[model samples]
Target: AEAYPKVKRNSKFKVLDAADIDFFRSILSSDELVESRSPEELASFNQDWMKKYRGQSNLVLLPNSTEKVSKIMKYCNDNKLAVVPQGGNTDLVGASVPVFDEIILSLKNMNRIRDFDSVSGTFKCDAGVVMRDAHKFLHDHDHIFPLDLPSRNNCHVGGVVSTNAGGLNLLRYGSLHGNVLGLEVVLPNGEIISSINALRKDNTGYDLKQLFIGAEGTIGIITGVSILAAAKPKALNAIFCGIDNFDTVQDLFVKAKGELSEILSAFEFMDRGSIECTIDYLKGLPFPLENHHNFYVLIETSGSNKRHDDEKLSAFLSSALDAKLLSEGVMAKDKADYDRIWTWRKSVPPACNSYGGMYKYDMSLQLKDLYSVSEAVTKRLNEAGLIGDAPKPIVKSVGYGHVGDGNIHLNIAVREFTKEIENLLEPFVYEYIASKKGSISAEHGVGFHKRGHLHYSRSDIEIRFMKDVKRHYDPNGILNPYKYI
Candidate 1:
């Protein structure tokens, strides 16, 4: 990876020395404290999943309990030592790693399933627990976590809360703000705030837990989470539809809502470029449709009866074909068929990166104008002479995302990360989103990469209020500094 511009470290923060190491060594076990400078142990922690962002932190601390985290935070606060709270480190926007030499505080060792109430379907667990494990635990009890992501096996429950992640299941279960009941956070000043309530409805003074839901660990470290779980559907089905143009894609979505009604769980859209990339990445996997189409949609239905749900989905697909809303379609018949259909959708992220590098933009737009941004970007790149298959700095442009929620994932697959391509995309893309009154970032938060670009989505007054809140909670600015407020 090319070296990114360096951010200056805060001079007020004290440099780590032997004395600081000794203090950490006293409170933590030998295995818990990873202070070695060896690249082997620190390599994974230093680089993000995309390998686009890299940090040079010399020390990494793993605390097994909340008490240890509190103590370490207190010491760092008193000494003015900066800290970065990391969980899973699967964040795409570079929020979980250090910018310079800040200490790495990892929550991997604190994973524990604290409690689960089968009657009310409430779950309480440590923040470091993997999302897959939580979902599996709920599945055994006939319940399901409200959230599901492609990175579920690696992403932590707490980390998802910190970013307010909205995954494929979001169209059905809604966002985490509604599912998350309470949180246990350790403030930057070493103060612990525990509001782990599992009640369905509670009209309290102020909803304090909402602050840390998407704060990205700037104000505090989320230690635990209490969330409401939904009952698992008895039957599930999925279908892949191919359409001739974007207009048909929109019409299909509108018709499915009315026809499928309550059984519809997910509606996803993918362009031809995205499917081409997937085919290249996942070789030998059969494409759903035989004929080439401009657009494709993956619709999933979940209900209590398999026979009834299948009949409804079949009728919906048949109607769509009769109306010419779909050119070709295939309904999954078994678990093997279902996985094969979804493999096309879930494999998009890695396929985007199969090229040398990828610049990803996740945005929320109006349903009618969802694909306009991607089209405009492709035109701009071609005009700038930065797009091609060989020798050129660019590879191709693609767009795919959860069309049900109007979130578009626009990816610019490139030969390498170059300043020319970035300069053409930054404010240009941000301005386009702002003009349409859409959020610059949908699921991915404004981490280090999008810090300077927040103005495109937020007003100056709003940013000021956010900064004031940060100062109130983290007076020293020692918690995830040099990032967004």
Candidate 2:
């Protein structure tokens, strides 16, 4: 590794004592920081779920408390070291895994539920708090932290807040942006600013706490958060509807949304290829719908009560069925049935990867232009001789996301990972997104993966503003120095 030279006005910060390993060890538990002396020890967090970025910088630092993280940050700040904060490491863009010259700050050790307020409907937990664990915490207290995702068990609250992540329930409950009430942040200078007050309204001054919410920890490390929980719906009804074309699918979606407002928790679509992949991955978990169909939608509704919710859901489905807006429809009768319907939607990513290598792109675009942009991207890639090629990133499978919220997740599969493919696909995808007045990053923030794509989503003025923010908060460029802005 290269030396950590003095770079800025605050360049007198001390470099870490790699020789005095015990100094670092005292900040963590015995099981916290693990280096690879053996293959089995390194296998757990070595390879991230994202297959594209698979390099290793495994000086993994796992601090158990905010104080420990603060101390580590203070040390790193003094040394002008860049720290990559990770939780569960379930990131798709390879942001969780590090490049060659950085140390990993794994938040897996700090997961702990601090408080549960049923009356106010807020849950305070450490950043490493797993979504699934929070769900169970809510169930125990008659509440739930609403940031739902497929990797609920693995992805932690810290990562979710850092990414300002969006998932299936985003259509109804809104993403982390809306539901998060407060946060406890670790600034780049190792100072702890506790915003976990759980107040619904605080119009004292500039809402400065928000800047780090989606900054992806490049500006600072988020130690814990206080989230406003969405009350758990008494009943959940899921339906699988297959459409023949994108136009028809769009029409049906508009109609369904026109009728149902917040009850429409999820409106995810599954391509035939994605459906088949799920069926293959889990033997008994059949696709539950026709594979030949060009597009399939798994619409889910969660209402305040069961019987009343079902009646309203039935009316919506019956009307759609009679209107011929849907080619097929199957309503879930039980929990098992609903899970079966969801398998198709969640399999979209794994399907894109399992079949071959993959390039995953998630964008925030106008709902009307979602499918249209996909078509355009595919056409442009085809013209560039990248779409149908064997070892290039090919737009082979397309799925639906928080269609109700205008966030779509699309994937391209190839036989191998190559710099050439990224070079070609990036400009093509990002430029098209910009053309459509869309953001290159929808839920996922601009980490290393989307650093180059920032200009596409941002204006010249916006880019300069972001640079100013970086300048003010991290003038030394010591906080995750090569990421975001």
Quick one: best TM-score, which candidate? Answer: 1
lDDT of 1 at 437: 91
lDDT of each: 0.90, 0.74
Q: Which ten residues in a row have the lowest lDDT in candidate 1?
A: 1-10
Q: Give the alpha carbon lDDT tens digit for every residue of 1-485 in model 1.
A: 54656567779988899999999999999878887558667878888888888777889998999899999999999999999999999898889988877899999998999999988888999999999999999999999998888899999999999999889978888899999998999999888899896488888688889999989999999999999999899999999989988877989999989999898999999999998889899998878789877888999999899999999999998988899899999999898999899889999998988888799899999998899999999999999988887889888899999988899999998878988998899889999999999998899898888888888889999999899999999999999888887
- State each candidate's clash count: 0, 3
lDDT (C-alpha) at residue 291 in model 1: 87
In terms of TM-score, how similar is model 2 to the real structure? 0.91
- lDDT string for model 2 (82-163, tens) is 6677888888765665554356788888889988778889789999988899889888777767878888889999898888
Task: Judge candidate 1 at residue 251 and give its lDDT.
Answer: 90
Cα TM-score per model: 0.98, 0.91
